[model samples]
Target: MSSDKPQNASESELPQAVPVRRRRWAPSLVWLIPVVAAVIGGWLAVHAVLSRGPTITISFQNAEGIEAGKTRIKYKDVEIGEVTSVKLSPNRQSILATAQLSKEAADYLAEDSRFWVVRPRISGGGVTGIGTMLSGAYIGMDVGKSAARKSEFTGLETPPIINADLPGHTFFLRADNLGSLNTGSPVYFRRVPVGQVVGYELDAKGGFVRVSVFISAPYDRFVTSNSRFWHASGVDVSLSADGLNVSTQSLAAIALGGIAFETPLADNAGIPLSDRNFILHDAREKALQNPDREMQPFRLRFHQSLRGLSVGAPVDFRGITIGEVTAIGVEYMPERKDFDMTVDIRTYPSRLDTLSRGSRISGKLSPQQLIGNGMRAQLRSGNLLTGQLYVALDFFRDAPPAKLIVRKGMPELPTIPGDLEELQRVLQRIVKKLDAIPFDNIGQQANDSLKSLQQTLDSVKALSDGLNKETVPQASKTLEQLQQTLEATRQTMKADSPLQQDVRSAAQEVKETARSFRALADYLDRHPEALVRGKEAQP
Candidate 1:
């Protein structure tokens, strides 16, 4: 009731006028802490999304030394990425390696980019990746110049011979076979290694093997249009007209094989185009031989054995090689009732034309005229040690007259017997003559003669013995008597011998009588009466 009544106006107004004022809300430091932390966390999330790189998968025949989360991809020994995982392919035939690369390596992932597992290797280019033996294997990278990007790739089984970044030129070589050459096989210019074989494949027709090679610059410029390439593998040992020849590029070529090229000094060498195609010869001599412009086929019929003579045997004119034997066969001669060896040969007339520049022939004589003038072919020994034979063409003034015969389409050239064959014929004739002699009859006659001689010798010996035993003593006694008689006669003829005195006295008496007769004759000449007188005295 007192409230309802009008109270004291000042007390009532004082109680109503005392209005309550709400205190302003105050902030805490704890709220500021959570707001700052949220801003930092947002910045970190955006940075992580921007820093990640592209992922790539590579296929390999095998993952021999590859490791996940451990092996790294390197370019020129610089780390560019890492292998994250390894697994088999869907076909279960190959291994697939998943790698994460840095952003800088994204451009290197081109269509032609090459990758290989680096391990210790010994090849024609020498030993490489030895450092990887201790550090473990890694994926090697070679960046390509292709503009198109790729995420999947097939890795190389072996490292590339030359890096893509290396300045060089590529060329193609065609060969009959691959020989001992392989990727990374050395290529030489005058035995100096200037390049390597990068790859090889068979031709579309499968008739030949085509090899691709890379020549480093400076040396690449040396390969000209006229340059000749040949296999320098192992040792080339040949016996030709020049004699035995042994050649090789290097010791490496003997083991791993190699190739060599050279430009002839006589040829003008122009710059070669990129990817130029050239023939790869089997030997250096064949590569350097001058091309023959003219070939003439001719046939030769030999009546003797063709042993030691081969199809490629040289056909020589005097001492110069002018052709080669192309074919060898046996043909039966119906007229002679015997078999004759037929040899087809190819002769280069251009070689003779060049050699006859200042000679008397001067390439003017025809084949018919040459054959008419005593030209003939003969087989002779070329190499005594190898028992190799060759056809020799020369003038045979004593040979029987023979004409060149053309049968069917081939012209036949005349042939004379080989020296050995001629000698064999002479020996056979001598043997036949010797065989005609009656050796057994002659031997019997000789034995009879020896018996007669022995009888005569025995008779002579018996006679001599008889003379020694009986006739010799009788002859000695006769000789002694003759000697005594001769001594007596000698004594009788001495100056004091009685017979000599008698002869002297008789001779004196005869001389006196003759003197007396002479005196009487003189007296009778003076007187005729004295002729009748027996004796007359001289005055």
Candidate 2:
């Protein structure tokens, strides 16, 4: 093979022949740039597709504290999304936030989910959100998944109003002041927290205020009766020399603008309780329900001089509060100068008896029965140290107190007799009778009579008592001596021997004579017509 191949030319002969035309990059290098660009573009596209998520638009009245891209969406306090874009709404009215929600939280975006902004509340009642004093502000939302619901959300002007879903139609309550009541302040029934404050508003009417409450399911049924939406602020009252004062017993319920109701239990009624969620969420659609007829506004009048007493004071009957004082006003007609308080009371008549659930007059109980076995109206001291008075209902009969009534210049409600008042009246009557007496004459006569009577009685008692102790001993000794003298006289008469012998001789003579008389008496006894009797025995 080596012999067959011809020897190559000198070293430079082969390749130095052609300085292979080199390709240029400024032009062809631009093609390489295209390849690099393709790789970068492909990377960006993959990232964009994989990180894709849903866009949720939330509109707010103001975006004072919320930041676009910084705002987060949450469900049950868990962060599920972040805002991506911020812009005014199409109407140029609201701060529209375009947020990207994590897929994990999307399922919770329910049709009934709610969104609101938390802020400080300033009112005459009191201030709320001490947190806002430091934490600035944030958005609170209840998430739900409902494609049917509007994808857009409008943040509430007021904070979220937490309330218990009640039975029947939801009530509309408006107040001028909601106090420091929070979104989740517990609503109570006689001090028992049964519901909570859910949200509030500056009423669409721009007047008064709107409060949203969440009544629990069973408690919602209690709302079968209309409830009073009042302030649950401070319990206030004043006590003075004129009379007892009281406030905020049952009316304490209104202090916080909470929900309270009386539900009548039944054996055959349909499910009267409503679900426990905001009706505005979805239950609003089913708000066409009729309320129970038996649930009526409890009525009571505080016919008294309510000096310093407020309208929202509690009205209790026998310690069990049945209502509250809604309006404290006065009527100037008929010379009956009185401050009459119109009360909004609530009473579940069917609940009067623990055993009876149905409404029937047959089960009507007497006031006394209520006091001992069923019910009692206790006039409670709203503030014992304050001497504020209120009414409470319960069963306590160990004490049968006296009734109450008006006296002096003090204006009083026609209250059921309390133990205290009855005692007062009796004392007053006795004092009046004593006042009617001529004290000077009676006192002198009584003094003289008491002195003479005491002396005479003392003398009689002393005479009888001393006779038994002092005179009886001497009388007993004299009687014993007289008995001994009689015995001695009888023994002396029998000691004479002549007297004994003569007595024997006479006895022998009398015996012969007695024999003859006996024979004669026998003959007379045979003669039935003969009389043989002493003068006294003849008849």
Candidate 3:
């Protein structure tokens, strides 16, 4: 009976079981696990893109329009990469453009590819990229794959070469209107583009312009030592008559101008060129290196007319420019006591070097050409209105062989004749002579002669009246005296008579006085300085 009661209690206990409920572990944790995993995976994907290629940081002096991710770089007009980030360098001297290059750009990236900001610039050489000057463009590159210089991708402050590279070349030149010569200006050879401008810097300290020119690789060897470069962009000098001009040919070209370089054909071995870089030139040294050298700078003192020419004028040799004007001033002549201006000339050194100056040289001559072999000096007109003069050179055979003459300060240059100066001097001398005539003395002499004639007529009429009328005693006496006087006057006409000789001598004195007076006046006019010690005044 006790066993049965225990079994029923056990069954009743089972009926007192528990209700079904959620455990302590959350069911939301299943969805939360997946959420955390997704966040981590998204972060990993971004990291992969960031680390896709080699990191390159390009530093520039300025970063006006550049922005990370916004700036893109193109290779052969194909978009290759975008900037990843922008940060100031340690010293704050430059802006570092960190870029994340794509696979293609990264593959072709060589040691020589260049990077530079596309910013507008203005210079004395020229103005450039004026159309899009307000909104700058993306960075540009000249991608090159080469064995040389291809170690790593390090962004350069200088721009890369856009055109082909030149092998062996060197050109010396000046940049006047170079404002347009930016990182993208095109370089032309015989009007055909073979190179491009890479970079530029203002060389204020050097007194010259610094320009980086890159010739395409194949043509690189063609550029030789006998070359010259000059800015071809627009330039305004405020000329007296010529108006404003504009030169726009390329995006990289200066808005005002571009550069023109020449490589003269020569068999001689020329200078070798490494990679392209900015060239700083000294104008004086370059002039000395030119092939056609000139005579050393010499001054020619000119007292006579040089064709009425003057300063800033061209000095020509066979119609080619050879020299320029330096100065012109007058100096006193001790003998003539007059002033004469001497013209100074500055000839090109190259032209001077070739001249056998002062050496006993001989050559053929022609009267018509007035030029033969020896050096001849002449005048050139620079500014017609200003009457500026410059010295010019010519060759004459028959003309006196010019001898190099050295003076105390600066040697004078050779000079030529001028029709204008000759005419002017002749007119001036004539005027001086005319001004010296003695009109006052001549007038007094004429008045005296007319009075004497009048008196003689009056005396003759009185004598006639006395003869026609009955003679009064006083009249008779006057007539007798008159007759005696007339007889005496007639006798005085003889060279020997005492009274006649006196009158004759007085007339001679008058003639001599007129001549002496004229001579004195002429002497005073020609030599006015002598007037200070002239003869004593006549009473």
1-539 per-residue lDDT for model 2 (tens digits): 77545454344356666467887756566589889999999999998777666667888887876777666665545667777888888888888877887666655556667776656787433566567557555566765435665567777776544421223233445555656555655565555667666667885778766666666556555454233333443454555797776545244344443343333333333334343222221011112223323432333344433444455555554443335555544444356654445333444443333223555642475333443453444344466466565555555545455333233432232334444445667999999998998999988999999999999999999998999998999999999999999987777568465677788899999999999999878867777555645323345
Position 286, candidate 2: lDDT? 19
Backbone steric clashes in candidate 1, count: 0
**Candidate number with greatest lDDT:** 1
Pick by TM-score: 1 or 2, better one: 1
Best by TM-score: 1
- Which 10 consecutive positions of candidate 3 have the poorest summed lDDT? 360-369
Question: What would you estimate as the lDDT of candidate 1?
Answer: 0.90
Greater-TM-score candidate between 1 and 3: 1
Please provide, for model 3 over 1-539, each residue's C-alpha lDDT reduced to its tens digit, 9 standing for 90 to 100.
Answer: 99899999889878665788966965666699889899999999998876676566677777766888688776655677788888888998877788777755665566666676655656544564464365445776666547454423445544344433435333333443345456666676555667666666666776666666666666665566655555555432333356654433444343534565555457356465442333322222332244543344556666675555556566676665666666667778899887766666666645533465644222322222332245667665556797765555766455564555567676544444554666778999999998898989988999999999999999999988886675677788999999999997787678677877788799999999999999989978887877678655669
Where is model 1 more than 4 Å wrong at Cα?
A: 1-51, 177-185, 199-206, 231-248, 266-269, 298-306, 326-344, 358-378, 395-417, 424-539
Residue-level lDDT for 424 in candidate 2: 63
What are the RMSD figures for all models against the true structure? 9.1, 16.1, 24.3
> How accurate locally is residue 119 in candidate 1, as Cα lDDT from 0 to 100?
94
TM-score of each: 0.67, 0.36, 0.44
The per-residue C-alpha lDDT of model 2 at residue 484 equals 99
lDDT of each: 0.90, 0.56, 0.61
| Deviation (Å) of 193 in candidate 1 | 3.4
